[model samples]
Target chain A: MTSTSLNNTVPAPQSTPSYADIQSIVANDFEVMDKQVFGSLNSKVQLVMSVSQHVINAGGKRMRPLITLLCARMFDDNPSEKAMHLAAITEMLHTATLVHDDVIDESGQRRGKPTANATWDNATAVLVGDYLIARAFNLLVGFQSLPLLQVFSDGTCDIAEGEVLQLQHQHNPAATEEDYLRIIDGKTSRLFMMATQGAAILQDKTEYMTALGDFGQHFGNAFQIIDDVLDYSGDSEVMGKNLGDDLAEGKPTLPTIKALELLKDSDTEGYEQLRIAVQTGKTPNAEQLIELVRSSGSLAYCKQRALEETKLAQDALSTLPDNRYRTGLYQLTELASARLV
Target chain B: MTSTSLNNTVPAPQSTPSYADIQSIVANDFEVMDKQVFGSLNSKVQLVMSVSQHVINAGGKRMRPLITLLCARMFDDNPSEKAMHLAAITEMLHTATLVHDDVIDESGQRRGKPTANATWDNATAVLVGDYLIARAFNLLVGFQSLPLLQVFSDGTCDIAEGEVLQLQHQHNPAATEEDYLRIIDGKTSRLFMMATQGAAILQDKTEYMTALGDFGQHFGNAFQIIDDVLDYSGDSEVMGKNLGDDLAEGKPTLPTIKALELLKDSDTEGYEQLRIAVQTGKTPNAEQLIELVRSSGSLAYCKQRALEETKLAQDALSTLPDNRYRTGLYQLTELASARLV
Candidate 1:
């Protein structure tokens, strides 16, 4: 765990680490944070417990909290228990957003598991999501750090705004790349920035904040772009979701926006088809639309963009202290970019 | 504004003041707080602005903020702009809860106006409601008072728990009067408590915190009780909702719970009818069910309970320094109870 051992154990930049590789570095902290995520649900209401535990348990790769844990250790080797608690709060907030998102999407399953909305009902999901959000803030107040509260509160507003903005742009083929970036920055990257920057604030490593925020934001953007690309190109069985689920929902992700842009001049028929699909959310030609987007050279363009963002994210991390934890963070961005490949 | 003037202007307990009469006392402050409730929604996202403004406009009474403003002035007549801001934040939180509640209840019209969920969609309403909650917390963090944040955050958790608890007891004929009280205490009274107690915290009037909280809790209980009573007894035109709406939704409010308790032994046929209504929420005998609840004497019992709660709330004001603001608060409680009469 010492700096020397960390440096010797760290891999060179050429090889990307798996998520497990990064997590192994902070295995103990992850265990405690994982427990705290459920332990924090002290609601006397049984339904709250059942729905909250279901959603939290159904959560995807605790990446946000993992980032928080890594960043906390990147500053001080032996960070306080507050770091683990804050990490748990981040996961709780993430879970709350997911529960609400499932309700909004009216999705029956996520990550191959039934959603809270599906398992219980919309009312149950919404209220339990609310309980998680409230409890997260309730615990954040326990930290008694106004600066921490400010970062989180502000970020939460941005997150909500981002989700709403995406809804606004839904079915609009004219949505620009800038709009896509703005949406992802809010809905995805903002929490990442909070996770890393929050660690700096909690550890009194304020000097590292700007760098950490940059790392989080760029990585978040890259992560989301990869996710969008995967929606068009990844294995449907592996994703546990059909291809173009976003398009079916009329979501204007970067791939769709970029495809529309690239197709407008050269292929009017293709442009009209995809544009109308985005507009009406009716995919009579689902396979053709997927093929149209893939054939439009937009996926390649998106992969290039994802790589650039990943690079920027890694570059931002170069400013932080060179340590095992920092290496773990660097590997995380690489792992995310690897998804693009 | 002074104690002497307050005593002279105060009406006898026998006559209750209307909400408007109480509001007129803080007319200027109320105006500014009303503007702030809209002004605080400074979301750059156009959709967010639209939905937030729509819901806030559809909001009823602005009672919570009024409580906040009154409590603020009661402690310090020259309360800071932060007080107005806090009052607005309280209203925002209240609106957020209502928006989510509408979604949970699948309500179409509230107060004779189309709800955000009805106008936009459940997705939009859920996200915008979330935005309001986040923005409220963002503003609360601006106060830089950990104690204030503590009060609001804790109260928020209680509110969510209460809502979930209500959901837990839904469609259960056996839901008790105690369960009903607990549900209202969390769902309705907690915010009222926060409204008054938050004002005390911001104004550094810690000594009045207990009294303000007690006033808020009891008043909240009374307000909800009257609301439930009205669901069965009040004019649909005045209430802007149907009689037996609670029973239709399978919500076991105080009136229904009490009615079932009262009819279980004395009127077996009435008891089974009402019990089936609550359990099934299939009110084919809607009129008969309403009649059964009415004849069971539960509305009168609920009304008496409401009166007792109102008296307790007014009595809590006795410890605070008597002034016009205090009188305004006392009259507010009386007005709530007058709904029963």
Candidate 2:
């Protein structure tokens, strides 16, 4: 769709591949992982099945599982069924988090579709989310590999802690960049790290764990930073969420945090206004605040930082064998960064 | 405390022990398990630690962990530190469920203490509940026993499914007694079974798993049935909740289900009133509804049924080695049944 360099070091691609193009690299594996996500849900309870299916079906891109699938193949070309199953588990865990996040955010819609909490009551959403988590662990135990269990269980805890850390920082306008990184690292990157390293662990490619983990973490950081940037700059119609939704929710994302820092010295009035908005979650001047952040040059800094993280992620991949799957992953980071342009 | 027969077959004790008295049989184990419940929470996230501590401290009876401690000793007189850790994990899982339950139920207080959802927001409660579940599994993985992971994971899935099943049956007056058993079996009994069987698994005493599982399931059934009975008969102040709270929530527990059946024949007018109340959850004449169920002889039947389950639980214990811990577990069931009188 568009041409961009995969990284500053790599030559510019003739054309940037779309997500579908990247997914097609592992087309058969992607299809199986997608099916297993729904197939693995074996709940005797009718409500559990219905709610779990609704949320999982509403999922976006399947990026985390794609990462898992790609990483599994990078280690072993003919990865076993366990790799596909593990990939499905990653998506299930992701869906579980989204289900609870909707309940927490009191969101009615996600990606133009109604949320589980919106379709059912909060009670159904919460319990079904719990069921998904339990079911994921139950399926993981079927592998009988303690190492696999250890990676997943430990990653899940970090994901939860990351979510809690985000809550702790909510409404605190003074939240620093370090605080933001810690929160996203726990909530966002940890799962990505798990997705990458999990395959290595499953394939008994323990030696590749560190490189895979670094690839995951840096890629995750880039992904979340790009997402935060889009919250300020992307089209509401395209994104299916309003601009400044994070600010209105008092979530101190990078744009708002950096904007606050940039405005503090240059425009004290603008600084106080944004700070109050963050503190009270009162976005009466939502349009004006968006403009202020845009004019403050914060988005440029955020894009630059996202690009830096993307570069580091691609660097980490250099240690692994060069293959189509690695190129797919490289293109993924570029695609995520392309959103910034 | 009131005295009750331990079972129809066993000779009645001179005096039935209270829960505290039964817990005193393994007082040292109970103390360590209690401390470890707090100590095992090693989250760097301040919010996680605070909310986890709040719910754990507000825990009622620590009965599940007590069951675990007692079962551990039944196999090995000198259980290792792992037993205490496992027992603590049981409590953590129990607390995790309670935290989410509060959010689902929108409960303001539990056992006279403010709930995590009530004290913090639902977001914080949901995330921390997740953290606890993950932390429990993470700790379980540390044991490096796939069998232990299998039992805990299976039981956790059942617990969540049971919760969803209860939500499905809510406000449905047509729910049958069988449906009630299935619901409580998942939501209540599964954890009890896990606590008992987990100890046997950890101690390498697979021979006793079936008996221990039966003991835990029946005991959990009796405990839940007795709890339902008390919702109609216990003191509001003493129970820390209003009488007929379950009816208010439109939960068709055994009392409500059985009463609907009995009243349909004895008094058609009374049957319609109860049915409407269950359907609408509009219990304006709450006392009258309580009276209608009481006069229909459902409470007596419930108490009789609870006694039957308690007897079955004691019968399961016949296969296990006779020891003070066995006596302690038997007394624990007696203590639960005593609440009925």
Candidate 3:
């Protein structure tokens, strides 16, 4: 439509394109795919269709589905209709979970606007999310790859499990890094892995399938760490949600957990204060605690770990043959760990 | 051990197998297989194992998983270890969804006991449910059948979808039998279908797998109808929960919908009162309305349809080779629909 779009579509982004550049390519696919998926949601039942449309039209970044498309394109030039269908499905699954998460969190806002739960009742939010998921399965059945279905299904289970695991770990200072990893693996990385691996399954690329799975796993962990860190340090307006909502809810995100572990021995007063805050669900002074973590270098420590995971993600990509999209995926790892707001 | 225990290498009910006989038989395998699958949960993390155990021990009827186990034993002489593992996974998945359901439903009690949300917190309830689902996948991986995993995974998605769909239909008097069927299929039948078909997948019987799926679909529909009827007619103590909780929650159960449809012309005053009660979540003397439905033959009408489904369930068994467990499964379907209390 625009000159820049024409230029990019003609030659594609260069090898190892920047995050913005990659997003531009994905934007095109996202728009087309969304229309296709949601369009098919039309039904004879007006309420079912209307409610489904309201939920679907809410808009998402479609990052997970983008990864799926990028990975499929990276491994092979000739992608099938199944790859596109699976890509759509990946987004649908992700979106379905988001609506349910809103209900579970009881949050009033998401993506800078009222969440489905907040706009409608929790009942509609629940049903719309369900319709999206069923529609996803109905679409995935088109792929006809039993293994792909298995992988995606397993990922969904992992996502649910991860959310549940995190729920149990809340307000408990004893929550370990291992527990944190398990939670992220289930909640975050599992879907990332499914998205990429599902692409591989569709492409029938065995060798790259495992590698893509690893890439998604590491990248998802890195992405979640950045999200946790941003929760503590970033601007609420830019991030599109309240800062420290997780902490207020008594969730032990990476920064808080690591900071608590660091201060366990020396700063008894600080540690006890933080523990009391978690129990009472009132951070005595939110900004002061944020500043303390910043000064203590725990945020920096988490950032470094996130960067290391980025390296692991890049290393996982080495199994695939050289291609522009592959290199773009490698750069995506770095972009994920980078601070945006 | 008692003489009855010696006869089965397992504990038998003191009152003998009666109302929930087939369910009890299935529950035995469920407990054993869950312990086996969750053994890994203990090796890695002691805390999650304990928390998960506490949640699992909270007690449920094991309806969905029982259907799976019964279906498995129906087709084959001795169900495979994979079948047992899948059965556990199915129950865990059901439990995971239930815990989340309480949070969404804001339910104070489940099965006549305080809900996880009431006992701990919404966050904890959410996390524990997630943990159960995660443990389910961990268990599922042992079977390593992608098709099997896919079926269960799709089931999970459907479960979530069904919950959402039912939420959308809440308090909408116009919600049709078709709408209710779609909701229950996602909520109730999807898992039931998965349970039976998952077992069939393990047995490598494609033809019977389809038949078993249909059997679960019909039986599940019938089971949910009975459950809805119990909400109106059954004693709270015997049913293990309050009789009118569904009405209080504004859930448009089948009997209520049917009752509303039948009473449209003559009982305008009563209907308006019913509508107000649902809106305010207050029970405004349900005796008259309940009696009206009882006399008008809607309950009996629903019961008749349930009986028809049971016949369909029994007819499905003809597709598979005859076995004692198969006959037991048929009996279980009749029991599910025929029970008054």
User: Model 2: per-residue lDDT, tens digit, A148-223?
Assistant: 8998998999999999999999999999999999998988999999999989989889998898888899999999
Q: What is the C-alpha RMSD of each candidate to the true structure, in Å?
A: 2.9, 3.1, 6.9
lDDT string, candidate 1, A57-76, tens digits: 98889999999999999899
TM-scores of the candidates are: 0.97, 0.97, 0.81
Candidate 2 DockQ category? high
What DockQ was computed for model 1?
Answer: 0.91
Candidate 3 DockQ, CA atoms? 0.24
Interface Cα RMSD for all candidates?
Answer: 0.5, 0.4, 4.8
**Residue-level lDDT tens digits of model 3 in B31-54:** 666665455354233435555666
Predicted candidate 1 versus true structure: per-residue lDDT over B1-341, tens digit per residue:
33344445576666677788899888889999999999998899999999999999988999999999999998888888888899999999999999999999999999999999999999999999899999999999999999999999999999999999999999999999999999999999999999999999988989988988889999999999999999999999999999999999988998899998899899999999888888988998898899889999999899999989987887788878788899999888878887887
Model 2 regions lying over 4 Å from their true place: A1-11, B1-12
Lowest summed lDDT across 10 adjacent residues in model 1 chain B is found at B1-10
Q: Which residue pairs does candidate 1 place in steric collision?
A: none
Across the candidates, what are chain A's individual TM-scores? 0.96, 0.97, 0.90
Native-to-model Cα distance after best TM-score fit, residue B226 in candidate 1, in Å: 0.4
- Tell me which of candidates 1 and 3 scores higher on DockQ: 1
